[model samples]
Target: MRYEKIKTLSELKNIIKGLRAKNKRIVFTNGCFELLHAGHASYLQKARAMGDILVVGLNSDSSVRKIKGGPRPVTKEKDRAKVLSLLWCVDFITIFSSTTPFNLLKAVRPDVLVKGGDWKVKDIVGSDLVTSYGGKVKSLPYLKGYSTTGLIKKINLLTPRRCAVRTYAAGKKGNTL
Candidate 1:
């Protein structure tokens, strides 16, 4: 079945409500997903297995910048959303600007909220909200050493190192060298 992509909060809410009325199980997961890696694919597959529908919340460009600092999310938001929207395990993708998935959680009210094993259940975003709504929160085992940050660090290490020259300008404004 061809799934539709939801761009606005209102549309997403409507879709979720409609799905719920049809008794469709909804699962949600959120992340930056700068570079879609093996771990991401597997995690998503697992998440989809736990429910009838899977919705991915992608952090907006500004949100990525705010949390990951500049030079982050090498992929633009449009590209990221497009890529995620095409994933086999993902039924829908939504872009959000919040630092956390709190607002989106309140709106979608997914039947299942999923995260990587790295987070304690209590600390995971949307955990409380899902539980409060009588929905379940789950964690998928993280495929270690398969994250975007780790990939970036590996790239940096593989590149040639530059020496920091310690030449003293020695208060050169006053010519104290």
Candidate 2:
């Protein structure tokens, strides 16, 4: 079934409610998704396989900054959501400004809550709520050697540094020596 991507919380809630009423198996996962990578795609696909509908809670730019620190989320929240929407496995996308997806997860109340293996089952937010209702929580294995932080670090290393320009300037200071 074709799912409309929703940005607002109210719209998402309404859609989720309707889907639930029809007894659709909802699968939920949340992340900053600062950079689109193969790992992300694979993880999302695996999570989607767990249920009929896959709802992705994308962290807003502000939330990314808070969780990932400054100079992070190379892509804005809207752009991140756009990238996620392009994936066939992604059924719905919602940009949440909260640092944690707890509130969003609680509202969705999915039948299955999934996260990457990096996260311990005990650490997954909203696990309690889902499990209390006989829902399942899963932590899928992460793809090795693929991460936003690692990607950023690699890019930084490959790019020429400003210190190289600074070294040239330092040699000409006051025309001494």
**Prediction RMSDs, each to the true structure:** 9.0, 6.7
lDDT of each residue in 1-177, candidate 2, tens digit only: 333575577898899899988989999999988889999999999999998999999999998888889788899887888888889999899999989888898888899999999889988888888899899999999999899999898878864543244333556643322
- In terms of TM-score, the best-performing candidate is 2
Task: Give the deviation of candidate 1 from the true structure as CA RMSD.
Answer: 9.0
TM-score of every model versus the real structure: 0.84, 0.86
lDDT of each: 0.86, 0.87
* Model 1 lDDT tens row, 1-177: 333574677888888888999999999999999998999999999999999999889999999999999798799988888878788889889999999999999988889999998888889997988999799999888988798888888777752335334444754442221
Model 1 steric clash pairs: none
Q: Give the per-residue Cα lDDT of candidate 2 at 126.
A: 86
Off by over 4 Å in 1: 1-6, 158-177
Scored against the true structure, residue 81 in model 1 reaches a CA lDDT of 80
Q: Which residue pairs of candidate 2 clash?
A: none
In model 1, the worst 10-residue window by lDDT is 159-168
